[model samples]
Target: MANSTALHSNITQVSVDSNKNIESLRMAYLILLVLCFCIFLYFLTIILSVYFTTAHIRENTRYVLFVYMLINDTLYLVLGFFLVVFNIYVINLPVPLCIVLVILSLTSFMATPYYLAVMSLERYVAICYPLRHAQLCTPQRSHAAIAIIWAVGFSPCVADFIALSSSVETKYFSLSGICGRPMLIKTPMQNNMRYITIIFSFTMVGLIIVYTYIRIMLIARKLSSNKSSAFKAGKTVILHAFQLLLCMSAFTSHFTETYLKDYFAFFPITNFLLLMCLPRFLSPFIYGIRDEVLRKYIIKWHSFAITLG
Candidate 1:
């Protein structure tokens, strides 16, 4: 009778512990949902603030890229949110639709780093070569450069889309399983291509950004006492570097998850959302908050709304 009573007591304790674990998981997800909603609201404010700001912002080439970054970031966040919701709701997505979703996701992922690289290069040229700036970085040329970046960014995704479409196995399209498992599994050749693309593309762009920033800093050092435009330009470049770090953190964390999962086995969904989804929102927020010019505009508009209310 004692043994039977002890077994019952152990079973009850196990059930209580299981319930506590389940409750903790639910609380974590609730916190993530609140964070996601807050980010969405912040994103909308940034978009609206930019839209209503003065013509100077609208006309500037750098700001043009900022706008593109926001749009791309929005697309990225929306796609991520939809995927999570779909996974939770267990809504079945069609095969072709899944392929399209994956392609779009890859395109956004590629465009972000390239955008930051271009922005860094722009600052570098503007700071290091003031004399040739007008001739070299004209509005028309800037637009063309942006177009080229987008095209190059999308190229790898297009290649994959074509390869996937041409595959004899129709099962590739049915990768809509919960936890998004099938998409993570790639052939050895695909893995090689991904590694090569990430290494080559990021290394080239990363080197360019680092070299350009170093040159800009050297120029700033020579005129350290001036407190002129060069100083402001250096500040802007530093902010860009922060944004780049955030962007790269997302990418690195994502790649780390697959390796981490082998050890942890039950990685939380919050990890992916925090690392991948959150960083995408940080770039525009840094731009809006750090730049004096942007800050003034946002503040002015914000005050006007308050007074009117």
Candidate 2:
């Protein structure tokens, strides 16, 4: 009888300890999520303030694309954060709501590479056809391009939604599940379509970046007077390719998490931050600090803020 009581007490202690450990882990993840979100928000606010307050930055086609990229990334991050939170808490959300969130998240996510491609092309035109750059990259054209990008980004999501609507019963939308792409994207057709779209988009963007980089390199070699500008543009196109690669890594994250799950339990969170969030976080610094014109205004704004503080 005494041994039975002792065994019961030991079991209770172990259970309590396990609960404590899980709670601690939950708190740590929560803190990490908040820290990352806050940091991105701070930098985004500063860069956006600079963009909005400066007339030239707002009007310039290149800057306009940069701003759109920033906004698109922000939207992606916000939805991603929410989805991560919901997944962590195992929150069962209405299927319709989850569908909307997933669609928006995916659209914004896909838009990044398209934006990068356009930005590279803009640089290519500026260097290869300097005289006609102004006519080719007008503010109106940039705005129209943004609209087209949105449409392109939404294409895959729309196709997925249509597929879902046809096969899924109305009762399923009324029911709740943990908000995620896997919850909605169940059909084999949806999976195949997703893979094809991703491959095609990445392939196209990669080719565009590669082509621009090569052209810029050729231009840099030929022109002594404009060599410096052409060289810088080539480097920028390379960075865009790097950024596109980072975005593409996100699609492989499922495999990554699966392979690493035994070794690292928090692999998903790490993957989300590194693969999903880090590229976007680096955007402001990559373009804002690297560009001479934007850097000049960013410096002035930083000094002004410091002085005010």
The top-ranked prediction according to TM-score is 2
lDDT of 2 at 226: 70
RMSD, candidate 2, Å: 1.8
> TM-scores, in order shown?
0.81, 0.94
TM-score of 2: 0.94
Q: Pick the candidate with the highest lDDT.
A: 2
For residues 181-253, write the lDDT of model 1, one tens digit per residue: 2454354555566667777877777787777777877888886554466667667767666666666666565
| Predictions: Cα RMSD each | 3.5, 1.8
- What stretches of model 2 exceed 4 Å from their correct place? 1-12
- The 10-residue segment of model 2 with minimum total lDDT is 261-270
Candidate 1 regions off by >4 Å?
1-20, 23-27, 30-37, 88-91, 171-176, 179-181, 184-186, 224-227, 251-256, 259-268, 307-309
Error of 2 at 270 (Å): 1.5
Span of 10 residues, lowest total lDDT, candidate 1: 178-187
Query: How well is each residue in 1-309 modelled by candidate 2, as lDDT tens digits?
Result: 999999999999999997788668767876887797787777677788888988888889999999889999999998998898888778899998999999999999999999999999999999999999999999999999999999999999999999999988878889998999999976899999999999999999999999999999999999979789899999999999999989988988999887987776566777888899989988988887899998887778778888999
RMSD of 1: 3.5
lDDT of 2 at 223: 98
